[model samples]
Target: MSGQPTKFLVPLLLPISWLFAGLVAIRRALYQHGFYKQETLPVPVIVVGNVMVGGVGKTPITMALVNHLKAQGLRVGVLSRGYGRKTSSTLAVSPSSQSQNVGDEPLLIARSCQVPVFVGNSRVDAGRALLSLYPDVQVLVCDDGLQHWPLARDLELCVFDERGVGNGHLLPAGPLREAWPRKALRHATSGQEVPCLVLRTAGIAGPHEFAVQRHLADFAVQANGAKRSLSSWWDTPVQALAGIAKPEKFFAMLREQGLNVTHSQALPDHADLQNLHIDTAQGDVLCTEKDAVKLWAHHPQAWAVPLQTTLPTELLAAIDFHLAAAQHAKLSSPHGHQTA
Candidate 1:
């Protein structure tokens, strides 16, 4: 989702984007008018998603959230749509789960967070299944479901990288999935502004948004639990690969660390790498943690560089406040966990 088209191209694609925006408006209206039902889970849900269609470092943020909540003694479970998985059935993720079964991101989160995770086509269903299986789970964190109206969320965190609302137009014309301020404004008009907190994953923070610091860990971990400094591979031939929305960013980071990435491959986001081949002779294969989850199954020699993130204390406090407030409201209601 990088290298977006020039602004001049916006005119040519505006009609289509307008159509898409209209459809989005209509769909949201349906949910608002009660024509379509929204389901609320038994536990509080915090959604980490983006306004534009691209990776904005949501998984790492989710992993950070998992760590923060666990420190508070909250049993948090994750739910995802399992985008690009082969199966459509809802299922719980495990350490042994393959990317083809539960998608790479979910599998990575499950392994990294060591918490229950469920994935399916429907986020609501996945959340329910996770709660049923892990009854003690106090909260649910949805990896990417801000626009998933069917699954009501108590809190939403919108993530943005350096490209904040890129060009600020709708899909095809620009990078946005819907009009940025307009859509959010519409929600405010409906008397519920979606209780969202804006986060900048990269670059300068926008107004009223918090900045999150992210950096690659100094060491990369092997599938067998072995670890080595990134500098150890500096002199070796290395094949760098990333299947994320912005693969170049990962490559650039590796280069910044003085690792010579002789060969770099950028596959589609969430791509199944069963057909791709990386020659070790090119050097050691270095990849993002999300890619490593899938790549390790086929290529055990590949090393995963995890992203270390620091979230602002104010943001964490806000999230905790919202979760507590939602829980308080839930306790006051006679009927447990009704739709919003």
Candidate 2:
């Protein structure tokens, strides 16, 4: 099973999907009605997530946002649930941290951006942990926690790939983690629209959504920090390995780059590679950046392709505008000054 809900089977699964959606609605109601606690962190929180189940280029966007903010001299930290990690304890991610212990994505973010990143089951816990350790951090970015209502966010950016809402049904039927327009509309009912931005990671952007350009980096980085042009492997047959939500997308991107992928291995998202066999000697092994963290330990020769993105200037402006608004609102609040 691809773990994807089949389109043809959506009608059959609609009943179950409705049941799941009802449960989700109830959960949201619980949070909204004050039955559950939603924590507003001292620092402004920006959430980047997707309504669909699979990856929608959130990680790259997060990195881009972090870099953008860092260029402005703003201290930024990242928080994640650290999916697929072995440890349950909340810990600050560092270059020395193991991917299996803190998750591949968080480890990559920490190393690539050289910023504070904390991983745990709860975004609130991760945010607190990051701030407790790094008091100078000015902003917090929560990765893939759109459904986590317990953590109040100043801004939410929901990303979508070319798939666009795929059949427009909820889990076990379609690709959606929640209903599309209905979920977005739920926020509008509160007046003055939702504090969310819809973005298209690939393909044409919708009338109201922002479009981001994502592509493979021209060069691949080796474990020794050596650079190799992706074109170098164009003539030779290589094995493309991706352990991501959409491995085929990576394979397609490699093809687009003119790489001759004779073999492609689509592993489960965040598969435990500690014991996985990788015979790089068979041929050139190419992988996504997320897989490089663990694969490098075992196969240093593997080529890890990094993704480069061009974010819309308007999006950046909006983000800055909102951050300023949030800061001012926080400062003028009667809740007392809370820093760090």
Candidate with the greatest lDDT versus the true structure: 1
Candidate 1 residue pairs in backbone clash: 237-283
TM-scores of the models, in the order given:
0.93, 0.92
CA lDDT for candidate 2:
0.84
Candidate 1, 101-169: lDDT as tens digits: 999999999999999999988998898788777888888999998888888777889998888888878
Q: Give model 2's clash tally.
A: 0
RMSD to true structure for each model, in Å: 2.9, 2.6
The candidate that wins on TM-score is 1
lDDT of 2 by residue, 104-197 (tens): 9999999899999999898898898888888888899988899988887888889988888877778887777777775442221122233788
Which residue runs of candidate 1 sit more than 4 Å off their true CA positions? 182-193, 337-340
> Candidate 2 at 245: error in angstroms?
1.4
Q: How accurate locally, in lDDT, is each candidate?
A: 0.86, 0.84
